[model samples]
Target: MELYFLGTNAGVPSLQRNVTSIALRLLEERRSLWLFDCGEGTQHQILKSPLKLSKLEKVFITHMHGDHVFGLPGLLSSRGAQGVTAPLAIYGPPGIKSFIETSLTISQSRVPYTMDIIEHTGGVIFEDKYFRVEAAGLDHRADSYGYRVVEKDLPGSLDPKRLEAYGLKPGPQYGKLKRGESVELGDGSWIHPADVLLAPKKGRVVTILGDTRPCPGVEVLAKDADVLVHEATFMEDLAELAHEYYHSTAKQAAEAAVRGGVKSLFLTHFSSRYKDVEHLQPLLQEAKEVFEHTRLAEDFGLYPVQRST
Candidate 1:
């Protein structure tokens, strides 16, 4: 799985960064893309990347703010013109249903595919065989949410040497054993898979926080996560502004990551006051100083989860 940061700016689009949007590319038996937070100008941002609008099977809205969801109607309308006939499911806070209904009604837009808009409260938002997404309310101006996308635990690798010791050759039966199935031989002896297989590898966890301040609920939601994508709308020195705006500062985001025991921290949602992103370097540096693995999220940057770690 990989995260494609299509937009990384806050409030409005800037020359360096657009609004907020992200695509989670999951490669399993099939290729699927999960989108989080379609901010204003999101469709325009997606055009600049390699993502297919048709492959966006699901969308999770963090809040109902204009910067976070103004692009929803436009993107959904454009999906039909781009030959996206697949049904899409949207998950968001309580106001999402009314927001989508009012927007689509005012625009007179009708989609060709089935669309399910779920007004979420809390807990697990969506779950399938490959991945499960859970959500919790965050401390923000509106009814904001934080999402945790967790892949299912993968099967343990089979030990070839141990398989040979059991007089088993590499064949169709070996594949069955790898699936935790027991097979009996003609000699009335049975071989168990648990003896030859290693423990299941825990799945990687990626947590995304909407516009929020440092809160205990966020720390609980992102506990031990592989990647914690937290919004840093201001520098460390702007703590007063952060509190006033109901947003987080770079230092606060890093503190949450450290307290949550996250392996890595990705800081995004930059303020649009600066012309060059170099101005934001010190803010990111402040985060990295606190959490050694913190990194500033750049537009079109792909953050791949390390498997061996």
Candidate 2:
């Protein structure tokens, strides 16, 4: 799994950054892509990357902010134009469904695919064989939310050498063992999966939060996450302003990452005032002081989510 930051600026687009949109690429795992937000010019950003709109399977909108959702209609229309007919699923807070429906209707854009809009409150919103997505309310000017994506634990691999030592050749028995089932041999002896299989690999957790101040929902969604993508829309000097606007400072984001016990933190949604890397360096330094494993998210940056050992 990987996260592709299409736009990382807050509020409005700047020459250095666009807005807030992230693509969670699950190509290797599921051969599809999940978009976190679709800010204005997000489609243009995708054009500059290696991503394809046809692979977009799901979209999770964090809030109704213009920067977070202005490009949804255009993206959907473009997907149809590209001959993609796969069903799409969208999950967001209340009013998201109405917003999407209204935009599409008013624009007279007809997407040649079924779209499922799920206006979730808080709690587990989606669950399938491979992953589960949970949502929690966040403290923002609008009714924003955060998502906790939990991947299911994968089954351990079978020990070929160990099975060979048992006088068993690779066959259907290996499949059973891999599935944690015991297999009986011709000699009436049984071999348990634990005897021939390695330990099951733990799944990863990724927390993606919308614009917000430090809140209880942040802790709930970020707890023990392998990667926490939090909004850092202000610097420490503007902590009071950040709180007033229901936005987080870089320092606050890193502190939250520490409190949530996340393995790594990616600070995004930067304020436009930080025009260039020179200005942005201080934000990264502030976050690093609080959490050593913090990274500043940049536009078009692709971050791989490595499997936990």
Candidate 3:
């Protein structure tokens, strides 16, 4: 899995950065893309990347802020125009359904595919065979949220050497054994999967938070996550201003990452005032002081979330 940062600015767009939108590409796992936040000009940013609109399977909105949702309707309409027939699911806080429906109605937009808009209060919102998503209410001016995406543990692979010991070669029987099934040999003897399978591998965890101040919900959603994408909207010196605006400073975000025990933290949703890399270095440095593995997110940056051994 990989995270594609479509926009990384806070509140509004700037010459260097756009607003907040992130695309989680699950191409290897599921051949789909799951978006977190669709800030204004998000579709425009996607066009600049290698992402395909047709692969967009789900969208998770963090809040109702215009910077986070203004591009959603336009993107949906464009997806319809592109003739993508696959169904899409959207999860967000209450009033999200109304927001999408109202925008589509006012614009007279027609989406050809099935769209499932789920306005969840909190907790587990989605779960399939491969992944599970849980939401936690966050501290913000609006009813914001953070999402924890937990990938299901994968089954162990069949050992080729062990199969060879049983006089088996690569074939459909190996496929069945790999699936944890028992296979009958030509001699009428049965071979169990455990006899040839290796240890199961652990899945990865990714936590993405919307605009918020340092809160318990952040800790809950980010605990032990392989990747924690948190909004660092201000520098350490602006802690008071950040608190007042229901936003987090880089230092605060890194502290939260430490508290959550996340493997790595990616700081995003930067204030537009930091126009250049030189201006933004302090934010990253401050975060690094608290969490050594903290990284500053940039527009169009692709971060790979590798599986845990």
Report lDDT (CA) for all predictions: 0.87, 0.94, 0.94
* RMSD in angstroms between candidate 3 and the native structure over all alpha carbons: 0.8
lDDT of 3 by residue, 138-253 (tens): 99999999999999998898888898899998889988988888999888899998999989889999999999998899999999999999999999888899999999999999
TM-score, candidate 1, is 0.95
Runs with alpha carbons beyond 4 Å of true place in candidate 1: none
Q: Give RMSD to native, each candidate.
A: 1.6, 1.3, 0.8
The residue-level lDDT of candidate 3 at 151 comes to: 97
Tens-digit lDDT track of model 2 for 7-82: 9999999999999999999998899999998999999999999999989999999999999999998999999999
Most TM-score-accurate candidate = 3
Model 3 worst lDDT run, 10 consecutive residues: 155-164
Error of 3 at 26 (Å): 0.3
Question: How many clashing pairs per prediction, in order?
Answer: 0, 0, 0
Ranked by TM-score from best down, the candidates are: 3, 2, 1
TM-score for all models, in order of appearance = 0.95, 0.96, 0.98
